[model samples]
Target chain A: MTRAVTIIGLLLTVIIGAGTYWVSHEVERLEKRYAGIQSEILAEQESIHVLQAEWSYLNNPERIERLSQEYLSLAQIDTLQMASIDDLPENADQHLYRLDKFGEAVAFLPVPRTRPGDLMPDEAAEAMIIDAPSVANAGGNQ
Target chain B: MSFMRFSYWLRGDRPELRPEQRERLAIETARNRIFITGAMFFVGFTWISYGLLDASVLRQGNEPAVASGTDTRELKTERADIVDRNGILLATDLPTNSLYADARVVKDPVESADLLLTALPDLDRDTLIRHLSSRKAFVWLRRNLTPEQQYQVNSLGIPGLNFQREERRVYPHGRLFAHTLGFTDIDNNGIAGVEREFDNELRINNGPLQLSLDTRVQYALEEEVQKAMETYSAAGAAGLVMDVYTGEVIGMTSLPDFDPHRPGQAPADARFNRTTLGVYEMGSVFKLFNTAIALETGSANLNSVFDATEPLRIARFSIRDYHAENRWLTVPEILVHSSNIGSARMAMAFGGETQQKYLKKLGMLEKPEIELPEVGGPLLPHPWREINTMTISYGHGIAVTPLQVVNGISTIVNGGIRRPSTIVKQDGAPAGERVFSRKTSDLMRRLMRLVVTDGSGKKAEVAGYFLGGKTGTSEKLVNGRYVKNARMSTFVAAFPMQDPKYVVLVTLDEPKGTKETYGFATAGWVSAPAVGKVVTRIAPLLGIEPANAKAPEIEQALQIELRKGERKLASF
Candidate 1:
């Protein structure tokens, strides 16, 4: 019994030592990762500071105004062009154009359209009727 | 075993015993050994735990060492940034590398100097060679170099050359915000302007210091003033835009301005801040105060007439009208026509003491309270006599900074509340001292509007924005005498006269007459038109909608009733 108790104590010490060694090694690895992340954050912050300064320099009013004058045909807003909401048309439906309906009406017009294959049956019929005259003109020329 | 046997023999305690007794003695010895070992382990663990606790919790309050290295003591004290109200960066610190040389380490001074000179052509070659050749341990060659330049110098791979990281105070907007932000010295010390005024706060605080200035408004004001200076061939020009209700200076410009990056190269006159530092006899704009005070003190009313058939003679100094209306003029007419004789009569009616009280209440008796280190105190008349009062009423004897004039007018037009002018943004509408009654302020606003509509300030009238202002054309005092042709024309204006929001003041020193102005170099011809252009440009930016000119409420607010035969005289 004395020998067994001595053996168990020795085994417990060995297990505890192994566990402590593993925990310390894991801690060191995590600490290295944490240091790397901290350095990355510092590097990112420095770049952000540099970028902010460059952004402000590029967006300076004097430079923007000169660029606008050289490249863009924009002018200063005149007071006469500004109108309050009260001056808008009373009938909102009449003023606002429905893009879908307008698209159907001008389906045969020689303009580029998105998703040309998604036309409804009625729109297809209208487009054919509008294109008939142009098609006949092509046939007569041939 | 020998020592134990000797101790037993010395005590003379040898006795024959049974096996059980021997075992009991062995157990006692073993128990004592285990107890001693446990005690030693406990003490060692407790001491270590105490040390860990002391290191973490007890010493936590100690400050981290800020002085990292001997060479970086001045550069490491990080300063707070300065930004406009809209968060556009005006001033900030940029970390840059400054080149230094260790003369002892330099192998070949001639080749190093040649290579360095090629990279930095601006540096004097002889000076650099001297610095590199000297036996000094360390010598500074250049400061605040660009990253590209530092890389180019580093690529040379010279042994003696080294770089020390330094902080440079950079003004990103350069001359655009020169006078307002001021500039720092080479050591990053605040030398002038708001930078000097709030140096302590900037050094201690880690957050950005926000100013009340709007860059958009500042650029517009500066552009207009620059155009005016060039068109009129004036010596210098100053312009200010202030929020009347809060006394916040939105934009202030004084030209010719210098770039803050190299303030040493600029002339002393360019560095002078005219808006706050230069005091001028701001001519007829002071008449707004005269009229407001007369109406406020019940000394004169809108309909009260002042005899202006001849110039008013007060002692040896006489006050004459610039545009003489040789007749009895009413209160509104005096301001509309900018009649100095009529303003003098009004001042006399109120007496000199009353005028002093009014001017003092308007914050014109002292230096303007603004967030700038270079503020000029008002040059007040020494004796405080009758002649001084009459001339001061028409803005001759008393001289004040342009900022004071703008603030004083802001007080009158912003419903008589006097708020100290500020360049820092406030939390909300600041509480102000009531200088004039609301009724008096309203009446003053109406009279100012009348000046724009049918008076000498007609040149300042915009189509949609209701602008009311006063014109002052005073001959600049040169060598104790007024120079007749060297006139300082000033125009002070408040926009949307029905309920004023902003007060703009434009002043031109010695503006020459152009053919477009028909040889008239007066405030009405020069400064008034500039004020009109500034108000038109800034109003839309401030989100102030243009109201109809025929709007009934505005018409009712600005309508003036004419007396019998007064309509004929109004045609002037």
Candidate 2:
């Protein structure tokens, strides 16, 4: 009888001790999971913040305006140069409207040539004499 | 003897081979066994119930955490960023930290307050100590601290000091778009402009906010107008550069403007947006529309001439120009001279009702409906009469906001399409409704070209750029008196009249003429030259190359042939 009583007391002690251990183990596991989740949340918050700043930096107005101005030349229209269909130049090869207003056209000037033998020709000398008065006048001739 | 035996067994130290002893022993053993079994059952039941209760409690507490673990669980989401047309940042939200305190756990309130105040001098130490020593569990110290402030505060490392996550709205461009973009309140609530209009959607959505404002164009326009204001010594000036075709407001400036960051520091006048709000009687500039109305309504044609031999005498008013040419001027010459007499004659021919219809059709004589909150309604003559028509023909008896004038002129030049102005850049934009016939638009464009070519708008002409515009100067009404010294000078212009692209308008209020200007404060003297300068600066930037080559065809079509007597007078 003494031995049986002793066995029951031993069983009670072991079961209670094991139950307490299980509860404590579960509580510790939950604590670790909570801390992990909290850290993850904090990291994500930081990432969002960084993204917002970068987004704004990418869309800086002043920088974009300066770049477009340098490259596109987004300028005000010059009203004086506004010409109609009837205003096309006579000597132009094409009659198309030119939006380019900054002297983009290639221009050619015609120069009359004089004969090289005119130095020896008598008739040419007389004609040159008429123009030579201007040259003489450059030397302060009366 | 048996009972005696039982009692003996119950308390027995020794007893052997007795039937009573055996029976007593059996009964005592059974009773002990029953008590042990019952106690074991009760203990097991109590422990089982306790375990179930604890599990349920944990499940209730953990349900919210698990349910919130799905997609709904978000630490923080990005806010919409505000950007200009060229992808420049105007406004953005940055992640910030706020300092809080667990007042109950604060070991030394006096020390904590002193340390916090040292980092943030704006904080009052006495107030901080009072708050920290309160019985409340929690108290806020400071919110939306900068990174440096956060680092400094964290280094203090006081017990019970905590940090809460927050966001701070930052405008890196500062005062550039103060009035237009507007600033948000302390709680990040948009109080004005596009921010206020679309606050709800932005709060819910996470993306970048786009605006139609081209910062480059804005800078040029603002700089030019501000310079004009300075050069002319004007009280204030407003300027706008808009794409005639798309009606996109490329740039707009209203000085003196305030900064969005520190709005409280700016004066009320500095906060006023003159371009969109301030309405003024824009004198002869309205003649452009009056003549167009007479021609469009079939009341008169380009060949129709007004009898301007004398100033028309009304009941209490007489209509005349600053320097009226008493001779009968042709329709084109009337516009060239900016003759108020000729304009009044044209308005009389069209009459009052017809004039109102045309003015309304031109988007004048009404309030300017823009996206901004600061829009001004037109100040129209209460008793609409024939006199009003005559006066309004030369821009009197009527007042309109500058924005309306620019938009109205854009309609006339942009193939007569009345495109409501927009500050938004859509990917695939649609065409605006046609306001005037293609014929009228073309003719009006020719007339406008003629204005700049040979008329009062000559000062507004930029070489190689077909700049067409009109000049207007109205006597400012101050304290119920017409102040001659104070006048509002305005110049409205458009370029490449053959194919209109942009419309740039400038206006100066109460401008004081300088010695260089010969003490003349008219639009032709002040605003016209400013328009010319702006065109010169912005044209090269917009890729419109200046061609000095003669446009013989346009010159022929737009050239003026003087009358026989005028030609004879030229020889004199």
Candidate 3:
């Protein structure tokens, strides 16, 4: 019994010593990783601060107004152009169809269309269908 | 003999100790060893316990004490940013490098100065060389260097040259909000405007200080004011757009403004904030207050008529109508004609004390409460005589800031509630003190609408926004005398008058009469048109839908009934 007790005590001390060593080594590795992550965070924060400032500078109202005047042909919305929902006609869907038909003519004028569907209005589509042979002949001659 | 004794002891031939004496001696030695080990362990345990306690609690308490000692100076150097109501950055601190040199350590002062001069051509080469050769321990080379310039200087690799990290206050919008946001000094200290007003809060808080200014509205107001200034060839102009219910100033602009980035280079006039800092006798616009007070105190009603046929003389001072009609005028007609005589009569009915009490209640008697630090107090007539009442009723002999004028009109139109104006964004509708009854306020709104539809402010009428306002034209007072033909024209208006939301005021100082104006430089010809244009542009931006003119509700609320013969006079 004495021998057994003595052996067990010796084994416990060895196991505890090895466990302490492993834990200390693991802690050192994690500490290094934590330091690296902290530096990365600091760097990212600095870049974000710079980008925010640049974004504001680029989006200044004066500069945007000037650029819009130079490049865009849009006009301010007039009070007469606005209509309430109740002002819509009962056949609103038919009016939308007419607008869609108008959209087709606009597509052929070298203006970029906003969407892929409804490339041409009904009238333009019909005209294109009737002149399809002549247009092919002209293309052949060119 | 001693050598013989040592050899005997070594050989174990000395006289032997008795068994009991030997055992006792061994016990004494063992006991001494055990006692020493115990004492050492006790000392080691005590030290370990003390160290654990210090690490756990004592150090944490000490840490703040130590950090605060070193951090107070650092905290003053670091500042927070400022943003508009919509989170647009107005002011921020940019990390920059300031170049310095140790003159005592510089190896070749001439060569170093020459290189630095090339990098910073604006610096004087001789001055830099002198600084480099001064033999001082440290010297300032240049401040706020650009990154590219810093790189070029660093590439030169001159000895004794170093860089100290510094923060430079940058105003990205530059001159757009110069007077409102103000500017800081080189040491990042607040010196003027909102910066000076909220300096401590800005220093302690790392978050952005959000002001109530909307940049879009600010830009629009500034654009219109600039156009008006150019058209009229005015000396200066100021404008304000405020929310009547919340008392939040959405936009405020003063012409001849400077760039906050380089305030030192701007002239003093450019740095002056006219909206809050300059006080003027805002002429007939004060009549709006007079009429409201008259109705509120039951001194006059819509049917009450005052004879404006001739000038009324009071104490050697005669008040005459600018647009005089040779007959009696009703209360609405008085405001519509902008009759100074009629307004004075209305004030007389209410008496001088009531007028003073109403003006004080409307916050016109004190400096306006805005976030700007340069607020001008109202200049009141000291004697409080009867003539002062008559003159002040038509907006003369008493001077108030443009901010106060707008705030007072807002109170009259915004259900008679007086809310102190602020430049800080508020979360919800703020409660205000009731200055006039709601019925009186509604009546005032109808009378203001009449002015736009039929009277002097006809030029201020937009197509569908239902704008209502009064115009004020006062000659600029110069050295105790009014300068004729050098007029300060002002227009104060509120939109969608049935339920007013915003009050806008535009003032032009000394607008020159142009050929286009038919040689008329009054508020109707100059400032009223500017107000109309501003309303047209900003109404849509603010998402306020235009109402149909013939809408039954609006027509009923703003309609004016005229007798058969009075219709002809109403058209005037």
Candidate 4:
């Protein structure tokens, strides 16, 4: 009985020892992974900071103005073209463009300096304006 | 064995026991001791193993996750960023590689120095050679190398040459934001502007400091002001844009300005901040205050008339209007025509004591308390005599900074509330001191609008912005005497006259009249056109949707009864 008890005890000890060793090794691996993730976050944050500074530099008014003048021919928004929402046509279904809306494409696009202070052209980068489906198609679907 | 035998003797065995029994007892005792020792070892191992299991699985992420998550805002750069009102970065700290050398490790100092010189042509050859040849363990070569230069140095693969990480205070927009952001020294110490004012607070490591300045407005103001300076070839020029309600300085420009990155190389004159530091008699812009005071004190109304028929001579000085109406001008006509004789008579209607009290309440008698270290106090007359009052009625004998003038103008137009001007962005409009009555403010707005519609400020009138201002031309005082030809021509304007939003001031020093101006270098010509251009450019950026200035409501609101059935002024 004594020999059997001793053998059982020794077996339990070996099992516990192996389990402890495995669990500790796994913990170390997880710790290393945690450290790796932290460093990755740090590196990404640093890169993002650099990108923000670059964005500010790229969005400089003078630089953008120069680039726009070289590329686009935009005109200044004239005071006559400005209209309030109250001035818009009441029929919402109608595709009615107010003076300000009418002025947007021609005013901010493709015009050189018309007067002394009529300069600042914007970088309206070839916008992707998807058109709506035709009225006939909508009527048929309904 | 001896120790075991002594313990056995201490146990004291019976004499009747046989040899076999004695051996059995000894064996049992040894077995008991072994059992106890094994049990202790097992318990200790169990405790340690349980601790490991609990920590890795159960208590995981308790300590380290807190550390990592909390430090997200602690960025890699040592210095915090500074942004404008729109979150545009005005100033920032960028990482850089500083070149140092491990002098003891260098193989051939001569070859390394030659390679270094080739890579960086600006470095001194003799100094480089001596530094690299030093027997010390470390040596200094240079600091804050650009990325391209760092790459070149790294490619050289020169032994002992190393790069230590550092940071540089970079102003990406250069001279555009020089006087606002200021610049840091080589060690990243704040030297001037907002940087100097918020030095300690910045070092505490928080988010970017957002200033009240709008970058787009600032760019417009600076470019327009710079263009005006170059066009007329003036001595110096300054411009300011302030929010009429909140007293927030949205844009300020003082040319010629210097690049913050190279402040040392810039001339002393370029480094001087003219908008805040330089004080000047703001010409006839003072009439806005004079008219406001007259109406507020009930001394004069819109219909009250004063004589502008001739230049009034008082105490060896002649107060002459630049473009004299040469008639008995009403109060509205006095401001509309910018008549000095009328303004002086109007100030005399209310005494100098009342003028002093009003000016004092407008925050003009002291230095403008702003977020910048470079600010000047107003230069007031010593004795505050009667003659001083007449000249000061039209902006002379008292010199106030451009900042004060803009702030005071905002007070006169913005419901008569005087809020101290600030550079730091505010969450909302703070409380203000009431300097004049609402009725008085409304009347002043009408007079200002009337000035733009049918007076000397016609050049400043945009189509729908309804800009109104006063034309000021003061002979600059030089060596205790006013020079005739050299004049400080200035125009102070407020836009959207019905509900005045912003006040803009443009002043040029000694602007010469070009052929375009027809030999007229007065404020009406030199600075008024710039004000109009600035309003045209900035109005859109500020999101101020233009309204019909000729609307009957606006016209009636801003129209005044100058003479009986005159119909004198145009639409507001």
What lDDT score belongs to each candidate, Candidate 1 first? 0.84, 0.76, 0.84, 0.84
Task: Give the lowest summed-lDDT range of ten residues in model 1 chain B.
Answer: B67-76
Docking class of 3: incorrect
What would the per-residue lDDT of candidate 2 be over residues B1-572, giving only the tens digit for each residue? 88888886676323674778777877777888789999999999999998898788756766555545443344433446677777777777767799889999999999988888778889888889998999578789888887788888889888888999877777766666776777777778888776776687668756667877776667777778888899888989899888887777777888888778677788989878788888888998898888778777777777666767678899998988776788777777788888899899889987999888767876787777667777788889878988898999999878898888888889888777787777776564346777677777777788888777667776776766678888888988776567867899999998866667888999999887765565667898789988888888777667674543244554543444433112234323
In candidate 2, position B259 carries an lDDT of 75
> Model 2: residues >4 Å from true position, as ranges?
A1-142, B1-79, B100-114, B121-143, B158-161, B427-431, B479-481, B552-572
TM-score, chain B only, every model? 0.88, 0.79, 0.86, 0.87
Candidate 1 vs candidate 4: the DockQ winner is 4
Task: Compute the interface RMSD for candidate 3.
Answer: 17.5
Residue-pair clashes per candidate, as listed? 1, 35, 3, 4
Docking class of 1: incorrect
**What DockQ results for candidate 4?**
0.12
Pick by DockQ: 2 or 4, better one: 4
Each candidate's interface RMSD: 20.7, 16.8, 17.5, 19.0
Q: What are the per-residue Cα lDDT tens digits for candidate 4 across B1-572?
A: 77776766766443358988887877887788799999999999999999999988888757575444553333546677899999998888888889999999998988989998889999998888899889777777888898899999999999898898888888877788888778889898999998889998777757888899999999999999889888888999999999998889999999899989889999999988888998998878999999999999999988776777789999898989866778777888888778889999999999999999999999889998789999988889999999999989999999999899999989999999999999889878889999999999899988888787677787887877778778888889898798987989899999888889999999999998775665667898889999999999999899886766446676777777666213234411
Candidate 3 lDDT by residue in tens digits, B355-404: 99999998888888888889999889998998999999999999999999
Ranking by DockQ: 4, 2, 3, 1
Q: Which of candidates 2 and 4 is the stronger one according to lDDT?
A: 4
Q: What share of the true interface contacts does candidate 3 keep?
A: 0.18
